[model samples]
Target: MWLLETTTLKPQLFLGDSTPYYAILSHTWGSHDKLQNLAGYVKIIRCCAEAASCGFKYAWVDACCIDKTNSAELSERATECYVYLVDATDPSGFGNNRWFTRGWTLQELLAPCSVIFFDSDWNEIGTKASQAEFICHNYVAQRMSWATRRETAREEDLAYCLLGIFDISMPMVYGEGRKAFRQLQLEIMKESTDQSLFAFSYRLNIGIRPIVCHLLAESPSLFRECGTIQAPGDGPAPEYSTTNKGLRIELPLAHCIGGFYSAFLNLTRKVCNIREL
Candidate 1:
């Protein structure tokens, strides 16, 4: 079903209360075209089911949730959107910065109230080398093809797939890939900072577009985290200090692949369009 009107989805705004949690509906591939699209929708419902099992009461997904038609409302609602969904993947020069949240879109970097645990054992899957196998075995993917076009795409995707898919062997696989991806990502950021023209392109490709995707992804995360989702406010914002940190930003390949597949399915709705495996 389509999302309700913007007015209908406009959640109540609060002062100090926390916003709902959201989950990313990444990954949407199938045996055929129709099945591929159906997979995207399935991820949304699956997120809800998994979240509910983890004490979460709500979730926000873009496909059947947000009313993108209302530009005014969407933009307005976007500012305080940081309450959930901090996309670790941005083409921005800050891709490697563990402190990248500071540059998050108005839609990300907000407070979270709930969390969804998929109990995904991607690390144990035998087909960890292939993204499709990762999804088929555990069902996850958050990256889009557009983002994967960069130089670090392969290594990053490899790390993500291996990190979340393999249970025992993930450490070695993830370490090797992470090291390589980090090196390449650092080079890109350095080039952008040193050169003038390169900096401009970097902002357009990595900074802006990734921020948009992140904002959209946060919706579902907010719903899943918080008991009730709502609009954000300028009250007490979340704190992020470089000196004080924990897990750095890292979006697994499953997440990226899932997002790509879902987006593709959404773009092409050819009835059960079957293609090669």
Candidate 2:
């Protein structure tokens, strides 16, 4: 008879946290004399502090959140977390911005999710551009699934799952982005050619930069001078339709689709100005 070691196996579990909101704050490495760029680090700290005031239950800051000595543990826990704050070095670095932003904010960054952005100005900028596009995609998909395919779908349950999914999915997305980029990187390395990751990243950068820029240029009014305003509801409710048109306004919310899309695009283009710069 072979002697067997007695050990208990633990089951993997995902009991969601009760915290209503979470945030991630990040900054590029700090070096003396790098004041201009280093300003981002200060802004990140302030942003995290502001988030806590906004009722975020938890906030992760790279300076204190991660244990650099323990890669194994970091890798494991990183898989499940909420929020990922990022700051890009420059405008041309949109590819880096997209990958890291998307990677750290995965489910919400792609497919479907709620997202927020801390702009270069320290104002959170996630309303009617890339962030909105990502959220709309998910919302539509969810509505589609519930209406036509699901038998036990519940709106409350969807809300619960949506928040948690945003948390855990980000790190996984980051890993995937790294892996995909690495494969392309290796191809360039092997060829020993003029091509590089930067070259391949150009097309992506061009497309994303304009979309975001134009969207912001058009919606400067939404952001305004105030950082954020508090509304008496779960959150700042998205008003998708409005029929207040000058001389005589009379309509229900149901009849506001035409104006909604028009306002959305017009404001987006004006605030963002992707076309000009």
Candidate 3:
């Protein structure tokens, strides 16, 4: 694990214990050469400066510090992450910041113990620790809804980046495409008995033919309308397990007209903005 020494007097490595407390940097990489750009170079310097001010002797900026060629480094964790909003100039413009739309940033935003936000010029904005009210209490479905608006370059990253957010880790087989998301849910099922995992449906506008989907959500985007769903009560769910054929479960579904059955997930919907817990 390589770390950037805060002092820019010269690029050098400082000896440290195996597990050193370090600050992480989260920012949007430009399509053009970010390493070659002057803004990008200054951003790294500013990050080290900010980290020094935070009393951290070491900092890890993903752009240049990470050795992408090494797969083992992908498993590393940080004490906190600093998010530099390159497109945001002030607090009011944050809602439209490009950082929020990035898929990789989703994990960066939720994974670390503390996340600090900074403006383009390195002005302090706020921290996510005190403001993250939803993560601790929100149900699986509702929490998954937060990533609907985010995107990744590779379709597989739509699920890969969410590894930390869900506290699940699996082998990263990039070319599998949408199967990665399903693999993520399967891994989540191992950690959680939350029945809301199955409470996903496609929300299409009128006149659009309903697209066929699997029992599990294909991507976080499918969890968009799931914002209103709530977790089930304390009642234990019927014994279930994942198999090659799919999830084998005993559900008490109600019979409906036209030979259809309705499976109430023991969930209630408020049908309004569910931003609050």
Candidate 4:
């Protein structure tokens, strides 16, 4: 793993288990970094400067630190993360910050065990623990909703960035288009029987909606309003699998008076913090 020495701002190599305490810098790519030389010249300097102030000897920024030409990656084991909110000048703008609207930031938001939010002036605004009431936990659909409004320059990255959030690993194939998201769903189903995964909406009236399907959502945007959807914690998830025809699953189907059966999904939603099935 490579970590930047806070004082000299030079990248240093650290092998397994010998890595020192480090803080990671997270921010929106294009605007915050100013994109001087593709290494995010301004952002890196400010990030390491903050690390040095906080008594951290080393820090990491995704842009210059990772070798995009190869499979090199930043260490995920780092527990402390510093979130640089370049768009927000004050703490009041936290809710409307551009940081929440980017695809890659979703991974950065969820991965760190501790996060310190900093304003554009590099002044401390908030910590993740300070905003506990607004954060959701554990539910699959809610976690997906967090990324629905986020975006990436590449269509494939919308799914690729989420690989770590779901604890799924797969080969990255760039030219696959929306199939990448579908493949991600297929991978998620393999590890979890959470019926909430299928509870996403179709993003009614969005511009240029993808060809809709009943089995899975075409994009994460369909899950925008699903933050309230809750997983069936102890409810038995029906056995399901993918087949040549489509997704095959055993759902409790009830026939209505019109002779149409409605399948009962093993999922619920919270209203006033109370679960309703």
Identify the leading candidate in terms of lDDT: 4
**Descending-lDDT candidate ranking:** 4, 3, 2, 1
In candidate 1, which residue ranges exceed 4 Å CA deviation? 1-19, 28-41, 72-277
Q: Point out the higher-scoring one by lDDT: 2 or 3.
A: 3
Displacement of the residue 230 alpha carbon in candidate 1, Å: 37
Candidate 1, residue 204: Cα displacement in angstroms equals 20
Poorest 10 consecutive residues by lDDT, candidate 1: 193-202
lDDT of 1 by residue, 104-200 (tens): 1211222222211121221112111222322221111111111222222244343332221222121223336446433332333332221110111
Relative to the true structure, candidate 2 has a C-alpha RMSD (angstroms) of: 19.6
Q: For model 3, what is the C-alpha lDDT against the true structure? A: 0.76
| Ranked candidates, highest TM-score first | 3, 4, 2, 1
Per-residue alpha-carbon lDDT of model 3 for 1-277, expressed as tens digits? 7788777613434343665788888898877738768888888888898889889888888766777776567666788799888877768665478888888787777778899888877887878865665444357887788788887889998887778778787888979999999989989888876777888877656343334457888888888877877744556655578888877777678776556675666677655544421
Can you tell me which runs of candidate 4 are displaced by over 4 Å? 15-19, 30-42, 72-77, 203-212, 232-236, 256-260, 272-277
- Deviation in Å, model 3, residue 6 alpha carbon: 0.9
TM-score of predicted model 1?
0.25
